[model samples]
Target: MSSVNTAIQLITREQAEQGATAKGSTCSPALAKGPWDYDLAEALAGIPAYGPGASSADVAPAATPRQGQLPEAYKLASDAELGERILAAKAALGDRAVILGHFYQRDEVIQYANFVGDSFQLANAALTRPDAEAIVFCGVHFMAETADILSAPEQAVILPNLAAGCSMADMADADSVAECWEQLEEIFGTEPDAEGRVPVLPVTYMNSSAALKAFCGEHGGIVCTSSNARTVLEWAFQRAQRVLFFPDQHLGRNTAKALGVPLEQMPMWNPRRDLGGNDAQALLDSRVILWHGFCSVHKRFNVGQIEKARKDFPGVQVIVHPECPMEVVDAADSAGSTDFIKKAIAAATEPTTFAIGTEINMVNRLAAEYPQHTIFCLDPVICPCSTMYRIHPGYLAWVLEELVAGRVVNRITVAESVQDHARTALERMLAARP
Candidate 1:
């Protein structure tokens, strides 16, 4: 199994030579082009939109940051050239810079990463290299923000492409969440019950913005990752009568449902409507208020895909991310975080078939790594997380070379005011146990 990028290119070329019917995978032919093309287009559009991929359809908020055109030299460089330049730049930078790549990032960019994992894991990885002056996060905007929050004051967190922003994180803005919080406060009041549980406590998924995490901290809430959501939610429930989970509804819903929270008790909160489009009685009766936000990539996985996988491979073990819809999760044999999925595959003593539902990049990487097993993505299409695709090798080479010249481009910094509260919320999460 080739890397997803190589596979996409091969599929695209084969399709062109033998007609569309020749290829089983369905992905935009545009994906076959260099991501720098979309990068340039996004820079020219001057509007908020996730570039081409799974999240291209997602409507970005007006506040989404945009990236300027890459220097022509980088855009014109061949893949081999970019790889050499990145390596040369890294060799020059030595320990002064540590590159962190997310699991969803393309293989082209991930090859240069000193540390590769999910966002939370990468952030913690940065802490291990404290002497590094720069943390180059090859993920999205929110991830870089997280590294900035957790890293030492002197360390600067840099995103290779500023346009690499998470669509799910953008779904829950600071203002919209603040408005929802005010309404909740009015309805639930600030006082705790006789059992010492407050009316509602905000709980933000790690995929959310820093300001959202700060909001959680200010209101006695905690942050959670997909792996620890159950523990965090249980932690929240111990101190609050109801929990408000945000940014990715699927993760919250799936995790809450696993914890025995009923469907009726978890009401969806639409930021556009007053009272989150729910009656006061419903709000009062809710045990968990879910925000209307989701991961575009995870949203692409469905029960139909799972059914198809099972039909194709009778004994296949189906594993999906918790960020997928409840129906998709319920249909799968197991749902867990990226780490869990990786560990499950690693733990298998014998070769086995797997149908994974997550970003195409990570799934394809797994398939490539485990040659003995037959592993495939649930979605036949090759669409990856749009934002993660934004960090192409060209951008990586450019950022790394810039660092070699004592210049930092696309540095992500959290405001001091938001930092304290956000760190507090994250700290609470770190201290939480199952």
Candidate 2:
């Protein structure tokens, strides 16, 4: 990753020169500030361009759904025009609608949010807005699903763009998890030990589908966020001999390792393989059975990137989210959630160089917010969460304006049956003290 950074820096510098060339004439100054004009910036940065008519050469092919059928008029509307329209619609809705923006969302969309937070924080935020008729989630699919499960039945949860989904969440489906559970039951009998503890307990990461959350609830388990994972695990182990953690192997591994679980006791479950690629002995001895899934964005950070930041900036503080690979988290000065990272920067009284490993949008926003501290992303590549990027200003305006007209577009509803169990799991997570 460190070696790749030099190449990215050279390319970005060249792109900056090109951007300076066409600065005032074609490129809006707003483009210079992010909510990056992805097309132009990608073209200039030697990073392949994406979004509407993106070529095959784009660095990673855009797997996320195309932006929904936005009004043709929005395509021609200038940024100022869109901004005015969004503001007008939001004003029209008033307290009837509360917009929730995730940290990974573009600044343009985030600007209109009533509140902004990570998945767990946003869940709590949803509870606070019980008076609102609609909860417009400016994040991904699973997040909206969680909100639907937690929010009042009368309060509709809306996802502006139906396409905004989490890649990591999609990796573990409910059916696969169910099958794995059955196999585990066969290996480690459903009976409890002498202390009356169950053989194994299910602990799904919050970055998972609502169905998985429901599974956890039905089986006497709870949901865990990156921030509260350790506490949640402690809560789990009190009633179970072993734990089965899913959707993100890295987080489970990192957290369990901290709790003194040996490497051999933590086995990775690959769903495609028979018995999840584990023998009966491995299953019986396992303290934490980790599901093979990871965040593509966090997985990009490496030990090399941390080393490079240290070499380049003397005494630089490296902070990473636990979602990062174990080695990267091990290399960092500290590991914490998005809010943790924000508070760390806020608490820094002296001039400090901070290198962060997380989503680019949040890191960039932090750097902008805390100018006294030299904040920079470990990865030089101009990559944002591809799925979160799906919620462009156009989608936001479309959804809000629809609500203004007494119409609900892109509403996300968890089935009543699923919601019942999922809500229980979420409530358990919220109650667990960290």
Candidate 3:
């Protein structure tokens, strides 16, 4: 990864000379209540049924569902029945449909995945597959939206459950982003630029909304997943003097600081704050302004847990994701994305002991995959990414069976206009390659 940085620097330096451009948005000084940080109650809601304007809630936290029972259609069906349905769906859809699954998906669903990996990898996977016309994205809404942006114009992307959205992504919506931009412009001018030709680049994590992506697309911005944050940031630096990273402030702060940015230069933007997260002194002094947002799942891990892991197993390698709280990341040996974790382990030559600050299922699976090596999750708590957990095997079986039938249920489509802007942002990252 360090070796890749030199090449990134050179390409970005060349791009800086080319200039920054924001083409579509007439709201030159873009404007956003940034999004709420968390809403656990949203997870309790079952995935809302699809079509236009739908919501899923098992019950309001203030209340409860009508009964303990899920829908009768949701009763656990036999695995064999599911297999048959999947085969029929494949036969019926033939070359027109593809299934994209997240690594966190249950084995039952993973078994049927046309492709399985992290969110960005899944999006890249969806972009290929020339045989498929409709992509059955088996992940959450943010993921499906990413696929829609990456796929061919004719391709139809679908999310089985409309309510299957990512809370992390929800943390930063367009309205809030717009408001933030408006505030920034008020302080820093309509387009904070050195030459007046440069536009402030907006880079969103893949864990954001289709609308957000469109916002980026419309502006001179693009979307990045955890796996490609560094690449995306490298791209942003070329287009603008500063970056406004959304939702996961920790990831933004951690990544920028690691790239040699000083802590004092990294300011947190809290939408709930009076200044829209901008403290004039901090804003003037900083380079990366992280929007106040976080991942409740990763936040669950703590430094104490890492200390305990070290005590339990001496000489264990402690690896974590930047999404973790700063103190937790400070205590770990290293931090990176899910793919980075896998690659680091794979690159290790000898049998090693490892502790990971990430989802337990992935850690457990890695341990099993590398029986010769020892691996464990940092937190002993059994909590999971609850939203990702919503993708139960029951839903998987139903989706596959539905595919086997003659009907195509959930298809995701990012309008071409949105894609046009989104593509510019994505191309910038790809172009950042040395």
Model number with the top TM-score: 1
TM-score for candidate 1: 0.98
The full ranking of all candidates by TM-score, starting with the best, is: 1, 2, 3
Stronger candidate by TM-score (1 vs 3) = 1
lDDT ranking from best candidate downward: 1, 2, 3
Q: What are the per-residue Cα lDDT tens digits for candidate 3 across 219-306?
A: 7777776767887788778777777789788898878877888988888887778776556877767678888877766877898999
Using lDDT as the measure, which candidate wins? 1
What is candidate 2's lDDT per residue for 1-434, written digit by digit as tens?
Answer: 22112233444555667864522221112222222345334445543323321011223323433334556676667778889999998888889999899988777788889899898688779889889999999998899999888889889899887656777887788889999999999999899999999999999999999999999999999999988999999999999999999999999999999999999999999999999998899888899999998887788789999999999999999999998999999999999889899889999999899999998788888887887889998987556676676676777888888899899878888899998898899889989988
TM for every model, in the order presented, reads 0.98, 0.87, 0.79
Residue pairs whose backbone atoms clash in candidate 1: none
Question: Which residue segments of model 1 deviate by more than 4 Å?
Answer: none
Comparison by lDDT, 1 against 3, better one: 1
lDDT of each: 0.91, 0.81, 0.67
lDDT of 1 by residue, 279-348 (tens): 9999999999999999989998999988888888999999999999999999999999999999999888
Off by over 4 Å in 3: 1-74, 91-95, 191-199
Any runs in candidate 2 off by more than 4 Å, and if so which? 1-67
